[model samples]
Structure formats: structure tokens, C-alpha cells
Target chain A: MDIKAYIILSLALFTIGIVGVLVRRNAIIIFMCVELMLNAVNLLLVAFSKMHAMSGVAKASPYFASDAQVFVFFIMVVAAAEVSVGLAIIVMMYRNVHTVDVNFLNRLKN
Target chain B: MNLTTLVFILLSVMAIGSAIMMISSKSPVHSVLWLIVVFFAISGHYILLNAQFLAIVNIIVYAGAIMVLFLFVVMLMNLNAETEPVKNYRLQLVGVITGGALLLVLVSAVMKIDVEQLVEMKVGDQGLIKVLGMNLFKNYVLPFEISSVLFLSAMIGAVVIGKKDETANQ
Candidate 1:
């Protein structure tokens, strides 16, 4: 595998997430974009994990080969938890504002 | 290109395309569904990388659970195009410009990277469930437990924050 391809793919996904976050008005859409960014990072980490396992230093211990993969697991865990909280917050916001438009929630601005 | 590269290209296009559609789609429900397609494409990438455990987990956590939560919230909100306020086009133009600039900066930075070093990289069987499980339980057990605590707190916080107190409102 040319690891560069994975890097390019991840960068594309991250850019998409960044664009979504910047362009979208809906709270749920922005939240999904954040999840997209998280997934991009997860993909990069897994690719690096495999790359490192193939390299020299990880020769002594196989455990080190999966280190980055484990980080991906934690990321997925945090994402799951964050999705629950974030969606709940979005739902609550919709209840209060009657719309999921993010621009409407500037009441907290200084 | 070999089959792996071909598969990689297909997954990449699907993922990036769906991600774009997810943001542009007017309906939040359709956006959520598009995001699910992105998740599945990412899972396919995981499988191609030989990270089967992560592939399955990606499907379960992302495609299964998180997307369902998003769908539920969207439906509960009863949001449609008319109900969904449209943002000013000027703001959208700026968003696109900024996003495009950032993408250029990042892609340029990545272009300078020395991928030749990684070409010699060899993958072990560590990505398999058995190896990953040993690593999780033995070396990373503390973080594993810590994540559970994080999940518990998130659950409590979501419930507390989302609860509608009718008496207080009345």
C-alpha cells in the first residue's frame, strides 16, 4: 500500500468536514461534520498503525504495532459519547429555538 | 493500478462525495443518511488496511448507533426546507473560500511529505481482534476503563441537559 494514498484520502475527508462546519447552518449537519473529521483522523491513525507494524522498530514487540489502532478505538469511543451529548444538545436547542439553524443561537455571544 | 488501489480509489470517491452531499443536502435526514454512506466507505477503508476490528466497530458505532441518533433527532425536530432557515449566500461564499484555502494549505503540506520511508513498512497481525484485544486488556486497560466512565458521564449530562422541565416553564 502506498501510504501516501491514505494520507491524501484523509486530507480530503478532513477538508470536507471543515467545509461542512464552515458552510452549514443546521446544528445536526455541523455535528455530523465533526464526526466526519473524527473519522478522518481515525483512518489516518489506522493506516499509520499498519505502517509502523511493517517498519523496523516494531519488530521486537507486536503489541506496539497496534498502538495507533488502540488510539483509534478510544477516538471512536469518545465520538460515540460525544454524539450522544451533542445530539441531545441539538435536540434541546431545537426545542428552544424551534429551528436547527445555528445562526439563531447568538444569544450567548459577548 | 492493482485491485487494492482500485478499491481504495472507489472508497475514497464515495467517502468524499457523500461527505460533500451530507453538507449540501437541504434535509437534515438526507444529510444524516449521506453521512452514513461516508461511514460505510470509511469502514471499507479500514478493512482494506486490514484493520478488521475497526471496520466492524466503525459499522456498529458510526453507521449503526450514531447515525440512528442523528436520524431520531432530525425526525423529532420535524425540520424541512421551509422550517429550515436559509443562510445568506455571502456567508456561504466566504465559507467556501475559507474551506478551499484550508484544503490547499493542508494538501500542499502533505505533498512535501517523504512517503518513500513508509514504503518499506510491514504490517503485523496486530490489527486482528485477538492481538488488539490483548493490547486493550493488558497495556491499555486503564484507558479502556476510563472511556467507560466518560460514556457514563456523557449519558448523565445528555439526560440532564435535554430534559424539559414543564413545571419550571409553567
Candidate 2:
């Protein structure tokens, strides 16, 4: 399979995720969108890693190898952690405001 | 098309469709369900890439655990279809345009890359769990330990944030 197709699909998913995060009023959905974006990037990163591994010359290059996948593993851990904290904050916001709309979260505004 | 290509096409379609549904559905529960489908499709993609370990972890973490938490939160909130706010057409238009612009940029960037050069690199068989474990325990140990700390912080934050305010009653 051509790598371009995979890249395109990842880009599309990332774009959709960006739109969802920007337009959605619900905090939970926005958080999901953020996850979607992260997943899309993860897909692209893994694809690049595979592409590099398949092409033998990348072995000499310090940046290319299964190490990229290791980076991706860390990214997954970080993303999971982020979602946990983010959802907790969202829950706190809901407790005080009874709503999760981003536009209405203007308490800091003087 | 070969089996790999065929599987890739199918999984691509499934992933994209479910992701679209995840964003478009009015019901949050329905969206979470669609997200589960997306997660499964992504796991299939990982399998296609020969990352068997990643595929299993993907299903276990995202599909099995995280999604269950999502569903539980959705149910606990009692968020019904009626409670969802409707998106205004103007905001939707802006979102579409912004998203479209980002997509265009990414597509163009990808198109300009040289795939043949990338395909010239030799793939090693050292991508399996054995090699990965060796690398993680040897070279990447610091990052690995740091990630556990990060997870600890996140857990503490979740507990503090989710805790009910006892003083409010007084």
C-alpha cells in the first residue's frame, strides 16, 4: 500500500478532529476531539516509522528506526494522562457551572 | 489488490466513517460508541503494520478501558439527546473552512515528500517486544520512569477534582 493514502487519511482525521474541537460546545466532546487529533498524529508517526524501517538506509541515521515507535509509546502514555486530568477538570467545571459550554467559561474575564 | 492493501482500504473506510459519526451524532453516548469503532479500526491498522503488541494494547487501553470510562461518565451525567446544544450554522461554516485549510496544507506537504527514498531503507526484524523491551530498559529508561510519574500526577489530579466538596454542605 502506498504511504500517501495513509498520510491523507491521517490528515483528514486530524482535520476533522480540529473542527470538532473548535466548533463543539460540549466539553466532553471537545476532549474526545483532542484525543482524535492525538490518535491521528500517532498514526502518522507510526506510519513514518514503518516507512523508515522498510527503507534500509535509515538505520545509519540517528532519528529513524523502531525508536520512533518508542516515541509514540511515550506519546500514548502522555495522551492518556492528559485525558485523565482534562476530564477531571471538565467534571470540576460542570460541578460549579452545571454546563460545559466553552463559550460560557468566562469566569476569569474582568 | 493484495490482502494487505485490501485490508488497509477497508480499515481506512471504517476508521474515517466512524470518526465522522463520532463528531456528527447528536447523542454523546452514540458518539462514544462510534469512537469505539474508530479505535478498533485503528487497532487493525496497527496489526497491518506488524505491530502486534501495539494492536493489543490499543484495544485494551482505548477500546476496553477508556471507552468504558467514557460511557460511565456519560451515563452518570444523565446527558440526554435533548441536552445537547445545537451548533449555529455560522460557527459550523467557520469550522469547516478552518479544517479544510489545515487538510489542504497537510495533503500538499505529504504530496511533496519522496516516497521512493523512504522505501529504500532496510527494515529490521528488531521491532518485536524483545528488542523493544531491551531498548526501553536500556536506552529509554529515564523517559519510561518519567511517564510513570506523569501518570501518578494525573491520578492524583483526577482524585482531587472528582472529590465532592464537603464544606459546601456546612
Candidate 3:
């Protein structure tokens, strides 16, 4: 497949994620939108890795294309850890405020 | 035209559709469920790109674990559609317009870049577990160990934050 097609698809998905983050007021939905953006980036990275693998330089190194996939792996790891901590914070916030609306989280302004 | 392109189009539609549904849904639980559908569609894309390791990991980690955590939290909070907070329609309109503007700028910039490359579809072994494992343990061993420490810290942080604050309660 043409790399441009993948790029466009990934860009569209990322745009949808950006829209989700901006339009939603729920903190959890916002977090999910962030995850969607991360996945879009991951998909593009893998596509680019394949593009690099098809290049002549990759003939010299068998592992040339593996770097991007490894980066995606670590991204997943960090995202998992981040979700744990973030959800914990969200839960604590709900306990205190009883709502997940981002608008109500303005205590810092005072 | 071919099967690969056809599958790619299908998966892209699935992902984008579910993501929109996730944001538009009123209930947090529904949003979480829709997000899982998006993850599965992305996993399908990973598989189409021949990144089998990432395909499996994305399903297991994102769809299975993290989404379940989100669902659990939503249920624990007893958040339903009726309890959902409403925002002014003008603010939502502004947000949608802003997001659309950002997309237009990014898409235009990306179109200007010269990309004559082809993505290797189901034809590469670089995405296999063996290659990834060798690279991870050989060249990237330090980052692997550091990631474990990061996980530990995150675990501790979650526990510390989630624990009932007796002092604050008193």
C-alpha cells in the first residue's frame, strides 16, 4: 500500500481524537481520546518502520526496522502505567467533587 | 483494489467511527466500550502492517486491561447518562471548530511532504517477536530495566493516591 494512504488514515484518526478531547468534558473520555492519539502515532510509526525496512539501507542491518516497534512497545508500557496513576487521581477527584466534569475542576483558580 | 487496501479501509472506518461514538456517548461506560472498539480496530491495523507483536500487545494491554480499569471506575462511580454534566452548546461549537481547524492545518502540512515510499504489508519479519526481543535485550536493555522502575513508581503512586485519606477525612 502507498505510504500516503496510511499517513492520511492515521491523520484522520488523530483528528478524531483531537476532536474528542476538545468536545468532551468528562475526564475519562478525555483520557481515552489521548489514548486514541497515542494509537494513531503508534500506527504511523509502524508504517514508517516498514517504509524504512523496504529501503536499501535496511539491507545492511537486519534489525533496522525493529526500533520503531520497540518504541511502540515502551509506549504501551508507559501508557499502562500512566492510566493506573491517572485513573487513581480521577477516582480521588470524583470522591471529593462527585462529578467528572472538567469545568468543575477549577479549585486551583481560587 | 487488493485485499490489503480493502482491509485497511475497513479498519480505518471502524477506528474513526468508534472514536466518534466514544466521545458522543453520554455515559462514561458507553464511552469506555466504544474506546475498546477503537482499540480493536487499531489492533487490526497493526496486524495489517505486519506488526504482530504490537497487535497482540495492543489488544491485551489497551483493550483488555486499561479499558477494564476504566469500566470499573465508571461503575464504581455510578455515573449514568442522567448524571452527565452538560456544557453550553456555544462552547461545544467552538471546540469542534478549533479541532477542525487544527486538522486542516496538519493535513495541509502533511500533504506537502514528498512520500514516495511503500509500506511493507505482511512481507516483513522485523515485527516478529524474535527480532523485537533480540533488539530489546541487546541494544535497548537499559531502557527496558528503566521502564520496570517506571512501572514500580507508577504502582506506588496509584496506591498512594487511591488510598483513603484518613487525615483529610478527620
Best by lDDT: 3
Which CAPRI category fits model 2? medium
Fnat (0 to 1) per candidate: 0.76, 0.51, 0.81
DockQ of each: 0.72, 0.54, 0.83
Measured with C-alpha atoms, the lDDT of residue B144 in candidate 3 is 100
Q: Could you estimate the TM-score for every candidate?
A: 0.95, 0.92, 0.97
How many times do residue backbones clash in model 1?
2
lDDT of 3: 0.89
- Per-residue CA lDDT of candidate 2, range B59-169, in tens? 898888877887877787777689987679898889989888988887998899886533211234444676667777878999999899999999998998889989989
On DockQ, the candidate that comes out on top is: 3
lDDT of candidate 2 over A1-110, digit per residue (tens): 57788789898888889988877788888888888888888888777778777766547644346676787788889978887888788878878888767878977897
lDDT score at residue B137, model 1, on the 0-100 scale: 95
**Candidate 3 chain B: worst-modelled 10 consecutive residues by lDDT:** B83-92
Over A2-103, each residue of candidate 1 has an lDDT whose tens digit, in order, gives 777788889889988998888888888888889999999999998887777667674777577788888999998988899888888888887777888888
How many steric overlaps are in each model, in order?
Answer: 2, 8, 0
Q: Under CAPRI classification, how is model 1 graded?
A: medium
Candidate 1 lDDT over B54-123, as tens digits, reads 9999999889988998888888888776676667899888998998898888888888887653522223
lDDT of 3 at A51: 88
